[model samples]
Target: MKITSDLKYLIIAVIAVFLVVNLSGCGENPTEMQNQPTPYELPDIPGFPKNLNIPADNPMTVEGVELGRYLFYDGRLAGSSHPDSMMTCATCHVQKNAFEAGIDNPRFPGGKTRGLPSAEYPEGKETPHYMLPLFNLVYNHNGYLWNGWVSEENQKLGSEAYGVPAEEPFNFRNLESLVWMTIEAPHEVNGDIEKSVRMIESIDKYPPMFEKAFGTPEVNIDRMSKAIAQFLRSIVSYNSKFHRYLRQEATLSEAELRGHNLFFSEEADCFHCHGGSILMTTNEYFNNAKDSVFNEERDRFVVTGDPLDIGAYKAPSLLNIELTAPYMHDGRFKNLDEVIDFYSEGLVYSEYVHPLMKNVREGGVQLSDQEKEDLKAFLLALTDHQMVNDPAYSKPSDLP
Candidate 1:
């Protein structure tokens, strides 16, 4: 039978439909899509609080933590592979120094951390403050950084200061934000995020790591930061002699016991700021009479713009205080003796001085030298030798 014009048109329509259906890939199998990465089970840490503040976007994963471990120690996190230009998160945070750059650091003397040499800051750039120890970070739900700048509620889409991508809003949430910030900060990595992503992607091993951790071989700052944050959160230090005493696994000496009492009593007034079960820090900002006058540009005022917050800084955890000397925000005190002496008789009253410092009017708590020695012994009990030498937190030997 001869086909008419109407029949011919119908045939053409059927052929077009078939072609479109096949080209659209509707026949492709679901197996071709990437498999979801396995969720990581976080270890139960002693004395840690029940409720954690992990971000909904980036849950912990074993592969992710492993990837973060490599990134945390690799100098390329700064977007450079050159030996002379190398700098990593580990650059300022050494494992032996309780993850803080201690005063004995030969490279950055006085425990003042510096980043890779940059044209804007030649001869390397020094961080405004001393490095905070990297332990019990998972407990820091209130915020990160000394001034409590990188907080949960304060995180936003982009900052001209950091050049965060606009499309990725709310990227800077929790410890993850710190990773990106450090990469861009002049006094930290002095790196560009786009460049960092590119450098990491170029590494043959990293793409597979990304796949294992994030279910894709793609590389980006978000993934990098999340992985690094995972590794950071995994760093817990609760095996100290003090922690052991609490667990009934060990005992403190007579002097240590006396110092412990003094630290928690009205006579010492240290527990109000540095006391807690899991972490020694209350994780709150305080002035602590560092100076009577404060610089609005510096101190907690820079972040909050609140006059009362002038000179206020985070009370760092004393978990590994012995290994983390010289102490304080600027690494001013050389040892525990100097630190105790300052608190004993060096407090200068200020309007913003934390009310916890009830003895500020008396210059300080005024502990006798003997008492000072006792206090030092107790603080030393907080040192966790195992944490400093933990093989898990160390740099991977395979990496060049």
Candidate 2:
């Protein structure tokens, strides 16, 4: 039978619609067509905690971590192209020093990190505190920094006073916030977010990396923060001699074993803050009686606003303590020996001193020279040589 004119037109229209739908997909945004990211899994480290503090919004991805490694080393991240103005996270957080500027670091003498030099402060503004090691931070739930200021519990938003708009991602919440904060802080990169973003976006190689990491070629401060944070979290240090000893894969020397006993014993009482888990830190804040007078306003009290926390600071993980020298928040101790001496017989008494320092009234644990040497030996056992030399954590030979 012959078809009606109306029926013939309807068939043509349907065919046209089908063709359009099929062709439209072929021209869709490359970002929309990108594959989902591969999830990054932590290595199964024996005796280490299984929980990680990764934010749901920013899941760990292999692509993200790789991109972060490049960004962490690229001096252009500071929004400057000049050689003199160049500064990156790795500038201060050298891998060899367990991500801290070592006391013997040729650049920053005594491990005191400083930001890019500006006319306001020609010598470069000194960082508020000594650098903390960047290992196994994925498991840290207590917070980041000596004062625990970069925390989820902190309600303060990024201030225009500091060059960033008051916003959600700008708050002191996680490793991501810490990245941008470092960029904006006067004592760090001392950069503008928009400027840095523009600089990164203009780089030819980064867009593809951005696409791989975030399913888009778009580069922004938020993505930068997340990528860097992912890289930071991926840094693990569970292969130290101490860890190997725990796994029964290695043996400690007699001196190291003796020091280990002293560390955990009530006589030395060094385990209260630095022990209890394989992480080697309770990750809690305490006033360790470093000084009788509290003057620095950047202590834990600044974050918690509690009087008792006046001079308190987060007990940093001691996994790479041997490498990360010029100890304490202010880099007060030049060497581990000085630190041990202070804890052994130089502890000053103060009401704010943590109760865990049981021998504070007696000026410390009062260990002998032999005991100090033994303790030093034990501390060295905690060093992870692999971490300091890991190629994955090192700066890429070629950066965009």
Candidate 3:
């Protein structure tokens, strides 16, 4: 058993390797590799359709959603760490406003939000369109945003599909794609992805949270995007008085009941676009006679490349629609009364108008004042107070 020089050297090498492996925590207790994320259970909403459009690559998880909630509210997610320059998704999409920049939102005067200040631009750039609510997004299988630009199929299609310059990246295929776009967009965060990643990675608290969520301490744009998307998807709203009435747990007031009938009746004809048990929206695009002119590049026509789609926008959910005002893509209507008035008499004729607008020829449905009041009551019944005050969706108090 006497060791030769070669055998002795081999034994020493083995011992040294073992020591290094143990020191690096790669041996027995590999906690890093065991950092598996716990699956998040989506709430069971009554009467809502199932089979949500969650991506397989990035499944929902408790830790991931928690991390996303923090990032969703954190201004640091913007490309820079400076307080003045920092802007978060929550800046425009507040909980009180049904995740939209409400007409009264302090940060967004007249419900318009601008990004970081810049000397080059001088005047800060504002978002081209009004903010859309983020709740019940899991059900929007066709796409995200007003024009359905962020879609599952479009990710592979690239910018050419949308008629954008070939050189421009057409990476928008899902909600995750919005992260990078907002960071780089001059009107959003006015930031760079690399800088954002670096900033988050450098934060002492975030790396540990990232590890818990993704099983690695490494923080990157992809992980951040996935996390935020999860949080956004988890923001379901089905606890309204209307929802309770549907579940047989409560009863609607007489006014709300009358409004409900008016909304569904042929007189109002409101269920065509904004109907569905859980979502309150068909999630389809329509011109809706918002404007006769279809010049904006953000219109649905940009995505479809069809002239008929001009001035078309997605039919937003009526769930929490009462809180998310001013109504329409541009936030033109100041209140539900104005919205009802527009639908009553403000119908503009357009070749691209949705075929479902049966009363378009008559300008609008022309509901009586009493009927309009009832319809507004019905719309307000869809408002979920629980959604706006949910602690889970609020900003993490631990964050500075």
Winner by TM-score: 2
Candidates in order have lDDT scores of 0.84, 0.90, 0.84
Per-candidate clashes, comma-separated: 1, 0, 0
Per-residue CA lDDT of model 3 for 97-196, tens digit only, reads 8999898988778888777777756667888888789999987797888999899768453333223343323268888878767776778777767788
User: Per TM-score, what order, best first?
Assistant: 2, 1, 3
Cα error, candidate 1, residue 186 (Å): 1.3
Q: What are the per-model C-alpha RMSD values against the true structure?
A: 8.4, 5.8, 7.8
C-alpha TM-score for every candidate: 0.89, 0.91, 0.88
Cα deviation of 75 in candidate 2 (Å)? 0.6
Candidate 1, residues 1-400, lDDT tens digits: the string is 9999999999999999999988677546444344556677666766677677678888988889899999999988777788887778998899999999888899888788887787888977888888789988887787788887778767466767766665563255588888888888888888878878888999899999998888778998889989999999888898999988998999999999999999989899899899955588889889998688775455777778888788888999999999898788877889888889889999999888888888889989999988998999999999999888988899999887
lDDT (Cα, tens digit) per residue for candidate 2, span 85-121: 7778998899998999898888788888887777877
**RMSD, model 2, all Cα superposed?**
5.8
On TM-score, the stronger of 1 and 2 is 2
Compared with the true structure, the alpha-carbon lDDT of candidate 3 equals: 0.84
Task: Give the poorly placed runs of model 1, Cα more than 4 Å off.
Answer: 1-36, 165-171
